[model samples]
Target: MSKSIDYGNMMHRAMRGLIAEVLEDVGANGLPGEHHFFITFDTRHPDVEMADWLFDRYPSEMTIVVQHWFDNLIVGSDGFQITLNFGDTPEPLAIPFDAIRTFVDPSVEFGLRFENQDGEEDDAEVVDLPDLDLAEALDLDKVEDPKPETASDDPAPAKDADVVSLDAFRKT
Candidate 1:
């Protein structure tokens, strides 16, 4: 039997690191030029901590917008903390990186989705990541080389260059 490389796990780790990078940038310097984050996480995850009211409201999952009105946004290696208003009261939350289900910066149309692995019995499931076009994230406008179109009678379907796939590493 051929061994399949666990590209999915590696990609998940990389995407999480990317999330950290974006958060670090936001923590150091305020969000740049309309850049904002829509972060979703599993509330039931062990590493997540929030108010009892919030858990009652969002029993399974919760999504927070880190655009405006958030205070003391601190991004650490393992997690992040921020204060947000919930019904006129400031609610502080501490969320670990593993509990994150999705991270999106809609301003640039960039996003990432992670598998909800908490309490899962199967570790062999492959994770499907979203379009990871991070060219805008790293500001690599002048450095990237444009792709050359292949000559064919049939025209190729339109697709964004930012979308990447890991199928090549999977065993057939």
Candidate 2:
């Protein structure tokens, strides 16, 4: 006789439970100190909307940092609404829980990543990030790209780009 276990099913249920807990706390006004969310989600989901460029630019996953300037965060049984400061503009967004692709709290190292329950047209994409130096953070204007390394007589070795895996992680 053979018995089997399905970790995928287990993981899916666990993630669902975690989301419910967070929403419950939000409803009760029990969000702990300095614990805002960095939510990355699908722009094309039925419940999400933005300027058309948002879908064209980040059709799969777009991360929004919700720390300093976010406001009007209201929770409901089906979804939530919040206001985000996009540069000089204040944009109000209403998002269903189903639209969430990822949630991370850099302050506590807590993170949650969600998969598209329905089929996805495109695989997720992550772009190259510039080094978070003070100079780059302060400069809102464009900066020139660094020149490619030139070959020396010693013939230095080349390097490849890195791939960050989202697997092996779950919200704590």
Candidate 3:
């Protein structure tokens, strides 16, 4: 009998690594350009950690949104720890990478789903949620920042001017 490679498990590991890298970046630099994450994990996973009330509420699976407000995002090789607000109460959670069922970023309309088969290795599935408008779904208004100064003594230029002009040539 010939042995076959476990491609499904290999792909799952790669996908989890991708998630870890993204989380690590966010933990270091913060979310950029309105990008955020919706991470759903299996609450029943042995490595999962959360408040008892939360576990009781979500007994099987729970989805947490990492957006406008989140704190203490520490990513480790095995899992990650994050504190999120739950109805004005901040709750800390520890979720193993293996427990993650889905990771979605609505800003760019990108998502990944992991399917676990009867306690066997997981298979990755790319999920595209097209028609999902985050702005309307979240019901939040967009906040625009004022034009940034270009390290110049003169008055700040207009938004369009700043965009057209390169920073290197701008007056200091």
Ranking by TM-score: 3, 1, 2
The C-alpha lDDT values of all candidates are 0.63, 0.51, 0.72
The 10-residue segment with the lowest total lDDT in model 2 = 159-168
For residues 1-172, could you state the per-residue lDDT of candidate 2 as single tens digits?
Answer: 5387755556655664566567557545634667655566667778886666546755765556554444566777666776654433566777776676666554565666565434642222222223233233323132222223322222443221111223223223
Query: For residues 90-151, what per-residue lDDT tens digits would candidate 1 score against the true structure?
Result: 68899998887767676776666665444652122222324434444323353222244322
Better-scoring candidate (lDDT), 2 or 3: 3
Candidate 1, residue 13: lDDT: 74
Candidates 2 and 3: which is better by TM-score?
3
Model 2 pairs whose backbones collide: none
Q: Note the residue pairs that clash in candidate 1.
A: none
Error of 2 at 70 (Å): 1.2
TM, every model: 0.66, 0.54, 0.74
Indicate which candidate wins on TM-score: 3
- Between candidates 1 and 2, the TM-score winner: 1
- Judged by whole-model lDDT over C-alpha atoms, candidate 2 comes out at 0.51
lDDT per residue (tens digit) for residues 60-86 in model 3: 877776776677999999999988756
- Show where candidate 2 strays beyond 4 Å: 1-14, 20-31, 116-172
